[model samples]
Target: MSEKILELKNISKSFSNLIANDGVDFDLKKGEVHALLGENGAGKTTLMNILYGIYKPDAGEIFLEGKKIDISSPRDAIENGIGMIQQHFSLVPSFSVVQNVALGLKELGIIPDLSKVRKRIVELSNRYKINVDPGAKIWQLSAGEQQRVEIIKLLYVKSKIMILDEPTAILTPQEAKGLFETIREMTANGASVIFISHKLKEVLEISDRVTVLRHGKVIGTVETKGSNENDLARMMVGRDVVLKIDKKPSHPSKPILKIENLHVIGDKGIEAVKGVSLEVKGGEILGIAGVEGNGQRELGEAIYGLRNYTGNIFINGSKVRSGDVLERIKNHVAYIPQDRKADALCGGLPVYKNLFIKAFSSPVFSFNPYLFYPEKLRKPAEKLVKEFSISTSSVDQEVKFLSGGNMQKVVLAREIESEPKLIIAVHPTRGLDVGAEEFVYNVLLAQKERGTAILLIAGDLYEIFNLSDRVGVLYEGQIIGYSEPDESHIEEIGLMMAGVKNEDKI
Candidate 1:
């Protein structure tokens, strides 16, 4: 057996009434890639945060190489050869890669040598097959390139223990494969990694050992060689989670939402969505599958009436005016945006307020536009809280206090309850766990049964295949291919997503 590089004994943490971790024990062997698997709210992030010094363990001791050490802050962890790369990149968008890396270097004086820093960055990039340009600004780089910059920062600090939190969540399949190669290179050079991910297939493929967590407790640790996806899923979720969605075939009706020759300019003044024409019929799901940043966001926003575009949008056979969000909403259009924080909910507001934000002007909860009947609002709010299973002490609690899963539930409950004819759901289950994901799928399916036309814009291929009646491949702002979600068409769809044009398929 290899030497144990790190260990946690009797680790426990709590936030008020909620226990995030409970008497957990975890160990990492030298030069080993250890995967920490869990569902959302399973304390995976909390445990890793404790190790990274972002949070202190309420009751625990950490050991490094058989010696107990106290890590009070990230600086202390870094000095002790530990570093964490978070899911959201922390690089300055306006700064170059070299500048971002050099920002916190104590040895780099006020007048630091830029050339030397660039040389070191290039060397590390080439060493790990991380093809990042040191001179390029962070905003100009792709998501995968930004991730490479994060890895380079840890290596530059001489960190022996690396913690990656959901590193592949935003990456394409090809980019994820490259990240696996980079992890192999790191472990080959005698660095241990604590890879925190919900992706089971990647965990089984990349990890030497796997540790499962359920409801803030360590279920068990097992060798990856003997563990399978079904085993891991059961342990993480404490049930036989149906990995595939169960849904009846969608029945087609008249077109509920129609877009013809849609052209929208991105924030950078470039045409992101170019002459795209598609129709989503009532009682059916039209899934748009593509790599992130392939104009999916633009397409969603254009349909929601949030972006200026030259297009003919018809809702229930009536033309929708350009950039009129209220009119679109009145036409029974509900949008579940990708970023829940920025686009959907008001974080500071109470849960009940967010629940009825779309329907505040309605007579059911309002006596007048200036005054709201509290008792009337409470009845509906309480019903939604119970219906969606939003775990909160009171409906008056701030939305930000809830966990990620509950926050998503609030959004789903709100949009689905609106009884919309057209629901534009973008990355609906992007950061949710298997259980919450299942809940979301059930809700969407229920809406489908109610004859709601859904345009599911997502990057997850599994979601596209499982839920979509007809799948369309969006590449470089155009619908490159369209096909039914049959198993035989998987290979052709994958090719179209990579911008490959198959004449026979398209």
Candidate 2:
């Protein structure tokens, strides 16, 4: 057997009355890519936190290369040669990549020489085959580019073992492939990597071994090559997982959502969505397929009244010409934003409070003017959290303490429980692992079966094909093609997303 780089034995953690991690054991071998798999609240984040010295384990023994080490803080973790790249990066948006990477390290009262850091960063990028521009401002870079900066930060710290938390969540397919290749290079150079992902395909492709977690316990660990997705799904969920979204033949009902001659400007005030007209019925999932930044974000924002646009929008046959975002929501339209942490969640608040944000004006939480039951309100909120399988110590736990998948579950649970006439999900399963993805698919299918209209804007072609009843391909501000979900081919969708049109149309 290969040498063990890190090991956790009998590791457990709790908050007040909630057990986040219950007696878990994990091991990583040198130069190995070990994957940690779980549903939301399955204790993955807690375990990583313990390893990274963000949280002290209540009871456990940690051995780094056969020597017990006391990791009291993040500084200690870094000194011990362990680094973690968080799912939501900690980069300063206005700062250049080099500035962001050297931010905290410079304040250690050392020589603040940025040129040296930039040189090291370039060398690290070259060594790992991870390309990044050190001079680029964080905000101007693509999501994939930002991820490269995060990886470089870890590498610059001289980390022997690196943990990547859902590294491919925001990447394009090509970008994801590039990231996997980088991971391979890192491991090939004799570094240990612990990857956290919900995408089963990516995990299977990149991991040497996979560990499955469910309800704060280890279900099992298996060699990636020996087991398939079905086996992992069964272990993670404790049963046979449904792998397909059941949908009936889509027929046009009365149009619940209509956009006529819509045009919207991008974040940089350039034309993004141009003259796009589409109709979504009350009982169908209309999928918008595209590469990222192909106007999908602007289009969803425009429909939800989050952006200024030149167009007409009608919901339930009523004109929403001048409606605001709140009005659109009140009119039985729920939206799940692409970036959950930025758009869907308030990290400072407790889980119940975040849930309250969903139905704040509803009668259940508010009786009338000036009278509200704080404790009584938690009943419904708790029920929703439990039903959705959101992992938290309690409904009162801070949302920041939850993992990415749990945070997403909170957003989905709130929106879906709202029972909206239309649900707009943008990249709904972006950071979720296989078990959580399965749950998300089931939730959407359940809503569709109940005749709720769904507008799914996703970059994942497979997800769009699997869940959508009808699919539309978006290019540079245009709907380039439309077809029934089953009849459409992924290559055709890819072409349209690349702004390629048929020669006949030209």
Candidate 3:
């Protein structure tokens, strides 16, 4: 048997009243890619945090190279050749890659040698095929490039054990493939990796061994070659999980949302959406498929009254007022923004408060002039929590403590419960697990059955083809192609997404 590089025995952790991880055992062999598989709130992140010394285990023993050791702080972990790259990066936007890597190096004196750092970065980048530029600022790089910088930083520290949390959540398919290659290179050089991801397909493709966690206990660990996605899903969720969505044929009614000759400028003072026209009818989903930063954000914002635009936007046959979010809400427009952290929920507030934030003005929750009843808010919140199957202890629990899947559920529960006529859902299931994604699809379909028009903007082609009645491809701020979701039209849609129009190709 190969040498065990790291091991955790009976590891446990808690946050206040929440038992994040029960007695759990995990181990990694040298040069092996060990995957941690679980649903949201399944204690995967908690276990990894303990391994990285971000949290001290309440009860457990850690072993490095067959010798018991203590990892009480990040410095201790780093000293022991362990490093972690979290889902949210820690790089400064304005700093260059080398500078970011050298920020906390104790050995590098106040006047550190920049040339040495750059050379080391280049060496690592070339070794792993990470393809990062040492002199480029963090903000100037794409999401994939930024991820490379994080990996390079870990390598620069001479880490033998790397823990990556949700590494491919925001990456494109091509970018994910590149990252998989880099992982192979790292493992080939005798380094171990603990990859935590909700993507089952990637797990099967990349991991040598997979461990499943549920609630706070270890379900089982299996060799990847013998297990399929079904087996993994069953182990993680404790039940058979549905990976595909089933929906009846869409019977679109009269138009509910109409945009004609819409033009909008991006934050960079350039026209991001140009003369785009589309209509979403009642009881239909119009999915826009495109790469990231292809003006989908601007289009969604313009319709939701969050951005200034020159055009006609009619919701329910009435012209929407420009830059009036509240008025759009009054007209029964519910928008689920792409950035849930910044645009959707207030992290500091309780789940119940966020659930009823938009409904406070309604008569049901208001008691007197300029006053609101807490009891009224609590009742509805309790009902929504139950209906949505949110995994929080109580409605009063802060949303920040919930998992990404649960936070998305809260956003969906709040928006869908309002009985809106028009729904603008942007990457609604971006970071959610398979179970939560199924729940989101079911909710959207239920709303569609109630005659709501939905504009679904997403980067995932599978999602676009799954639920969209009509698919439109957006490229460089233009609606390049439109077609029904049929097998024959997929290749054409792909070409359009790459900015190649059918006519242009001809």
**TM-scores of all candidate predictions against the true structure:** 0.94, 0.93, 0.95
Write the residue-wise lDDT of candidate 2 on 275-386 in tens digits. Answer: 9999899888999988898899989888988888898988999988543887887788999998788888999988887887856667764567467666875898899888
| Candidate 3 C-alpha lDDT tens digits along 1-506 | 27899989999888878888899999999999999988878888888888888889899999999999999888899999999988778999999999999999998998999899999998888899988889999988877789999999899998999999989877877789999999999999989999988889999999999999888889998999999988988888778888878877888999999999999998778899999999999999999998878899999999999999998999999898878898887898999988787788999999999998887666665556557567778888999998877878788899998877788889989898999999999988876777777788888988898899999998888787778888999999999988777667878888888899878866
User: Where does candidate 2 clash, by residue pair?
Assistant: 198-432, 198-433
Q: Which stretches of candidate 1 lie over 4 Å from their true place?
A: 361-397, 504-506
For model 2, what is the error of residue 141's alpha carbon versus the real structure, in angstroms, after optimal superposition?
1.2
* Reference-based lDDT, each prediction: 0.88, 0.85, 0.88
Ten contiguous residues with the weakest lDDT in model 1? 361-370
Using lDDT as the measure, which candidate wins?
3
- Candidate 3 regions exceeding 4 Å error are 363-370, 486-488
Q: Number of clashes in every candidate structure?
A: 0, 2, 0
- Backbone clash total, candidate 3: 0
lDDT of 1 by residue, 1-506 (tens): 39999999999998777788999999999999999988766788888889989899999999999999999899999999999998667999999999999989889899999888899988888888887889899988877889999999999988999999889877888899999999999998889999977778889999999999877899999999988988898988888988888779888899999999999998778999999999999999999999888899989998999998997999999999888888887898999987787789999999998998988656654566767666677789999999876767678888986766678788988998998999999988876777777778888888888899999998888888878889999999999989777678878888998898778544
| Residue 380 lDDT, candidate 3, scale 0-100 | 87
Q: Which candidate model has the greater lDDT, 1 or 3? A: 3
Report the CA-based lDDT of candidate 3 relative to the real structure: 0.88
